[model samples]
Target chain A: AQRVTQPEKLLSVFKGAPVELKCNYSYSGSPELFWYVQYSRQRLQLLLRHISRESIKGFTADLNKGETSFHLKKPFAQEEDSAMYYCALDIQGAQKLVFGQGTRLTINP
Target chain B: EAGVTQSPTHLIKTRGQQATLRCSPISGHTSVYWYQQALGLGLQFLLWYDEGEERNRGNFPPRFSGRQFPNYSSELNVNALELEDSALYLCASSLAKRVRGQPQHFGDGTRLSIL
Candidate 1:
């Protein structure tokens, strides 16, 4: 069974501070990871994917197969970065996503 | 292009009743996926349809079923709904081709309340 776990249910940080949303997964096979974010009134959108290895919106996540973790990180947080962040794992080639409990990120002004 | 769209932004039903949620994928997309966003469960994949066929489904009961139309739109039918069934249902779409690893685009979701 593939599982995604986001340890923090809520994370708060001041603007310009570094942000790291922790994510851990339990999967026996090779994994594909993705970070999805949902703003106040916006739909859930893709933030970044490990397969692409490209950063989006100043956020990046590296797949650590040894540790089974794919933590989303940003050098400096912004007020507009406040949103609900979800870490998802793709189940092999099935295109199914197993999501974490999600971390609500709040950047204070 | 328009993003994935879900109909009936909000739905209210009583226990034992049935709830049907609709999803229209983005244009040119051939795959549609359904997910349930309960209070604490986060997002659980419910169903996946491609090319008018049910490709995959989550651990949900048989009461949770859905189908994709020829046009690539989809409908999720929940039978004999229970209070625990109340949650926000989200729809997403992506290209069926697996080579590209296309990201799934999501909709605003429909809030279903079971009384």
Candidate 2:
């Protein structure tokens, strides 16, 4: 069975602190991972994908096949960065997304 | 261009009743997907439709079914709704060109509350 896991349900950090939102997955085939963010009163939107390897909003996630992880990280946390973040896995050729439970990050000023 | 759209921003129904949710894909997009976002459960894939065909479905019961029209718009019908069936149903669309890792555009979603 394919599954995505975000171990932290809630994470808090002071402004300017480093932030890391962990995500792990279980799949038998090569995986395509993505990070999605949903801010208050806003629709869910794509944050970044591992394949793109580009940073979005100063956040970067590296897909580590050996560890089965794609943890999202940022050098400095900002108040605006607070939101519900979900880690998703795209089943190749299936056009489906398996999502994790999501982690709500709170940046306290 | 307009993005994907979903109807009836909110819907309310009682147990054992049926609920119908609608979605319209972005122009030129032939693939439509449905997902359920329940509290604490996160998002779960429900169904996928492309070009008037049911491409694939997630691990859900037959009571949770849907279809795509020739216009690429779709409707999801939930029969015998239960209390646990309450959720925010989301619709997404993408080009059906078999492109590897194509990103999907999402709608605001319909919040269905089962009474």
Candidate 3:
């Protein structure tokens, strides 16, 4: 069974500080990883995908097959970056997502 | 292009009652997905429909069922709702083609509260 785990239930950081949201997965097959964020009063939206290898909104996540991790990272966190971050794993070709418990990110001014 | 839309922003029902949630995909999207975001449970895949067929479903019970219409809209019906069933039901849409991974666009979600 494919499973995603986001270790932190909540993470707080001051503005301009670096942010890293940890994510780990347990899947036998090669997995597709993604980061989704939901801002206050906003719907959940895609943050970044490992396959794309492109950064979005200053965030990037690299899929580490060896370690079975895909941690989302940002060099400089902004106040607006406060949101709930979810790490998801796509179940092979089925494209069904298995999401983590989610990490609530709060950036203090 | 309009994003995915879900009906009844909030729904309240008592135990043993039935709850029906609706979702309308993007204008040209042919795939619709349902996910349940319960407190601490995160987002659990519920159902996936494409081309009016049920493609995939999570480990939910038989009481949780849904169908996609020919026009690509879908409805999720929860039979005999229980208090534990209370959660935010989210609807998302993406292109059916698998060649390139199209990110699933999610809606605001329906807040289903079972009393």
Best by DockQ: 2
**Candidate 3 docking class:** medium
Steric collisions counted per model? 0, 0, 0
Show model 3 residue runs off by greater than 4 Å. none
Q: Indicate the residue-level lDDT of B31 in model 2.
A: 94
Candidate 2 is graded, for docking, as medium
For residue B68, model 3's alpha carbon misses the true position, in angstroms, by: 0.6
Give per-residue lDDT, candidate 2, residue B65. 95
**Deviation (Å) of B16 in candidate 1:** 1.4
Which 10 consecutive positions of candidate 1 chain B have the poorest summed lDDT?
B95-104
**Model 1 lDDT per residue over A16-107, tens place:** 99999999999998888899999999999999989999999999999999999999999999999999999998887678888999999999
DockQ (C-alpha based) per candidate is 0.70, 0.70, 0.70
Is candidate 1 or 2 superior in lDDT?
A: 2
Give the native contact fraction of candidate 2.
0.61
Identify the runs in model 2 with alpha carbons over 4 angstroms from their true place: none
Give all candidate RMSDs, comma-separated: 1.1, 1.1, 1.1
Two-way lDDT contest, 1 vs 3, winner: 1
lDDT of 3 at B60: 98
lDDT of 3 by residue, B1-115 (tens): 8889999999999999999999999998899999999987789999989999988899899999999999999999999999999999999998876443458889999999988
